[model samples]
Target: MPNDFLSPADQAAAEQQQRLLAAQVVRHDQLPTTIRTVAGVDVAYAQHSDQLVAAAVLLDAATLEIRHTAVVRLGAAFPYIPGLFSFRELPPIQQALAQLPEAPDLVICDGQGLAHPRRFGLACHLGVATGLPTIGCAKTRLVGSYHALGHPRGSTAELVLDGEVVGQALRTQPGINPLFVSIGHRVSLATACHWVLRCAPTYRQPETTRAADHLVNQELHRLLAAALPPAPDGM
Candidate 1:
């Protein structure tokens, strides 16, 4: 069966879809005090093509050990558009998540959350769909501003959008790039940043993202290899 939601027929339909999902997106403090499991979602695109690979990595939050990993390769069902990236990537991502053995307690997404212009990023979409505690931990600035934060492991600055604080620029590690943390669904900004820091005891990026990126790269390599045509017999 085809995923109709992925490919919006027109701009009006895409806007309407975002409005509908935005209505369902929850932004609050509904987080678990003790996180036993955590998952991260990421996507990689093939060069000059719509082909994409989405990967999900589950980990034991307490020990940061691998629990399960799932990956899916497919041509992106939707076109790429700013502020509507979820539509392009969520199909494969959802497929990968469905392949997971079990759902994780928390989902850490590699994109914006409530910080988006529409307040509905990939994390928000995924969270509403799965009804899981999800947080967006983006690596770059999407739409926000902040003062220079201190060069400390725990320092943070507010990420403002539309004259309101939508996320936080958190320094999980000293002297490295900070992460943009925001509420996705069923989670608060404070709790999200806290978990992000805990998940990044060593590196700047959280363990969940690191693990997911590694797995996604592995899957991407396998997919590219499979897609490559056979060499000539003379070789």
Candidate 2:
């Protein structure tokens, strides 16, 4: 698919669609008692081109070891609207997910969930689209405010927005910046926080996220390099 650069009218319609679909978000724990495998999803784009890569990496939930990885290259399907990123990123991500050998027990998205202005972020959209348990583990806060957190790991503070508790600012590593975790779909905030912490035993970002990011970045770079003309006379 190519970037459409949706018209203002189309963008309005898309926002409306998001508002309508936001009602479908589950916001509870509907996952299996024992989560065997967890997948992380992320996207990377080629500079000066519509080409983008989406990566889905399935990891052993117990050990955070990579099990299966899928990467798909495609053109953007929608414009680069700030809050409407899922519209542009989800199509390729869904393709990558389908490439996986088996559906993951749960998914961790590298974006917001309920912590968006409209309360529907990439994680929420992905969960509803695939009917899978998902969590949003973002590197930064999208919408909400929280008080200071402890330097020790596992420290957390409520992320409240518009008088509602939308998510939590969780400290995954000691003395490191916290991650914004929110309930995407079919999971609770506490459970989401737990999984984020479990997947990120040493780093600020989860293993699933790190693996998927690596895959997408590598794929994007490979594709771009292949597209470049051969160096003149092998200089």
Candidate 3:
């Protein structure tokens, strides 16, 4: 699929379609206090193509060991438009999740949640689609302003939206870049922070997300390697 194929009217229709999907997205209640399993999803793109390879890694919360992994390739129809990333990413993520042995207790995504303008980022998309508890642990803020967090592990500042506290900017490692943590669905901001920290053993990123990111890069490079290369004689 190419953007050139979408007329101005078609683009408008696509945006409207996304809005309709967002309206149907389900929001869950608070999550269970103890999360025995957690999964993370990340995506990588094939250079110069409207294609993305997404990876999902599920891990046991206690042992922090991966129990399952799945991958899917998506021909992105939705543009990389702000506030509508779920439209571009979630379809393939859902496919990847379907291949898992068992659904995870919770999910974490590398994007926003309620912090989004439409309040339906990648984590929310997956949460709604799977009816599972989920949290958004993004590497950067999307739609809110917040004060700088303290230079200590576990220090956090509130991510406020329209004068309401929506999430937190958490410092998982002292003096390192902080992460934006928000409740996707079936969880609270507090629980989101707790689980994210628990999953962050020795890095700024959670182990689950880090593992998923690794898988994305790994699988993407593997696919690239399997493709034909230029002839040595430059024929």
Candidate 4:
């Protein structure tokens, strides 16, 4: 994608190494109860460059079996802005999504959704762009506050926006940090939390998303190592 495609306001922030828009809501909905395939998306950055890498891995929602994987590498023009994370990450994510051989019944993004300040985060942006049902499953809270829930992994608390409930904070593993689950587009916060807990076997993060995070980071490190020249001073 070209930098010109990014909004002029967003582009101005990019040039200064700053970001605009903490968050905003784009869209959302509920997915089919009997979901077949779920895709996990994650991004990793190069050691010292504007290069951003994204990977999408599809898996059987029920069996937790991997089906297909896609990857994208692109120059990241957006800065490390807290609220405007989607703007920085969405381009690479879109590329990876486009390369997927098969469309997934659902997509889970490693970021925020309605849980964000602007209500639109990485997951929401991508969901709107692809017109796919997506869920934002973040390892930590992006905005808002929540009362602690039951100790069990399935316990949850509503995420409110302007006095209206928009998402949830779910405890995926008992005694572990809860995940901020929110509707991206075409999904519900309740169903988002339900699927997240169901997909997690024993970790705080769901298997699919955890695996995707690892995969992208691995590729990132691999590329960085490849770019390094062998020791030339001696050996």
Candidate 5:
């Protein structure tokens, strides 16, 4: 992929980096007992273009009120590689997150972490780089298989891959689809799932993810509209 920010790496080299990073992923607890502030990170891509927008939304964990938000427009430096999506998305996300007024105690990623094919997903990548507790709260499974969970909220099933437990399929709302929750870094899998459910009281997706998604999409649309040429007056 054509990248302006990072150096090019072949598949073998990239997977090797994933393996090394996987070893550094901390699945144990490494955070404060109480999480007052939470953050969510997501990226939205412009159709058929490398242009993209990333957003970081920080919220009051108790009230789900948005506290701070940061958004940035930039081009991705890597292709949509299956296990290495962090390379394409994290640069802009990290930039936006760095601009936040206050760093959140915990970060929820709209992607995978330990549930990845390499066990090193965007959440892990960002947490390690930023030294923050992170959780991967994916809308869909990136990898792993799980037995069907109960239909009621708080129901959970183990997500296992390669005969190892990596994450959970959790029901956040009654009769709704389950979320794929996993340990990113500095947080245990159980804590990740607990936070995800706590942040998602009404909706299926956590407030952090919803807030960041809304911000990124709004920013991307504004940018696209601004890039449009003026319409001819005589038409």
Candidate 6:
């Protein structure tokens, strides 16, 4: 990735671009009747450096077993803007996805989707660009408010932003913090929640997200270690 850091003027232009691209996101379900495979995508950044790694892990939808994985290391192309992170993360993620042996039936993004200020989070951007049925299962809320949810798993509350229902806060496991889920593209909110719970049979986060996060962190540590200077002969 090239560090084409956006100027102040360019950042405004990028924001406008997000507004335009958000309109193209498909809100309804356009996924296969039965999703056989799902891909999870996540990004990891190097401390004090633009270098980052993106990983995509494909899993059997039913069994939640890892099927394939791909990883790409690259530099951030755009400046770190709060709401414009997609511009910085999308390229490497797409590169990783392209390396997969087969296209996944669905993609789960470990970030926001429609639950964004511009309605164009990384999940939405990736979904629209790839025309894939995608879902956003974020660990934290970006720009939304939801009522208190039940303690039991599967409980959910509508996430409202600007007086509009954009997503939901769902409890994937009993007594655990909820995940914010939203429609990325070609998926409905209800359906998105359903698949998220299914993928997270035993954890707070989906298996897809967990697997992808692990892959990126593992690879990042390996790269950092390899780049480190050799230790002294006798410390």
Q: What TM-score should be assigned to candidate 3?
A: 0.87
Each candidate's TM vs. the true structure? 0.93, 0.94, 0.87, 0.87, 0.94, 0.95
The CA lDDT at 69 in model 2 is: 94
User: How well is each residue in 117-211 modelled by candidate 1, as lDDT tens digits?
Assistant: 88888899889878899999999978979999999998999999889999999999899888999999999899899889999999989999998
Q: Is candidate 2 or candidate 3 better by TM-score?
A: 2
What are the runs in model 6 whose C-alpha is more than 4 Å off? Answer: 1-9, 233-235
Candidate 2: misplaced stretches above 4 Å? 1-9, 233-235
The Cα error of candidate 5 at residue 44, in Å, is 0.3
Instruction: Please write out the lDDT profile of model 2 over residues 100-154, one tens digit for every residue.
Output: 9999999999999999989999999899888999999999988899999999999
lDDT, each prediction: 0.88, 0.90, 0.81, 0.78, 0.89, 0.91
For residues 53-115, write the lDDT of model 3, one tens digit per residue: 888899999999999999988787666777767767777777788788888888988899777
List candidate 4 segments past 4 Å from native: 1-33, 232-235
Better of 3 and 6 by TM-score: 6
> What alpha-carbon RMSD in Å does predicted model 1 have with respect to the real structure?
2.0
What tens-digit string does per-residue lDDT give for candidate 4 at 1-235?
3544453465445433222322333344556667899989889986578899899899998898888888888887667778778777888887787788988889888988777766667777777667788888998887887887889878888877778676788888887878889888788776777778878878888887887888889889888888888657764
Q: Which residues of candidate 1, in runs, are more than 4 Å off?
A: 231-235
Deviation in Å, model 3, residue 160 alpha carbon: 1.0
* Per-candidate total of colliding backbone pairs: 0, 0, 0, 14, 0, 0
Pick by TM-score: 3 or 5, better one: 5
* Model 6 lowest lDDT segment of ten: 1-10
Q: How many clashing pairs does model 2 include? A: 0
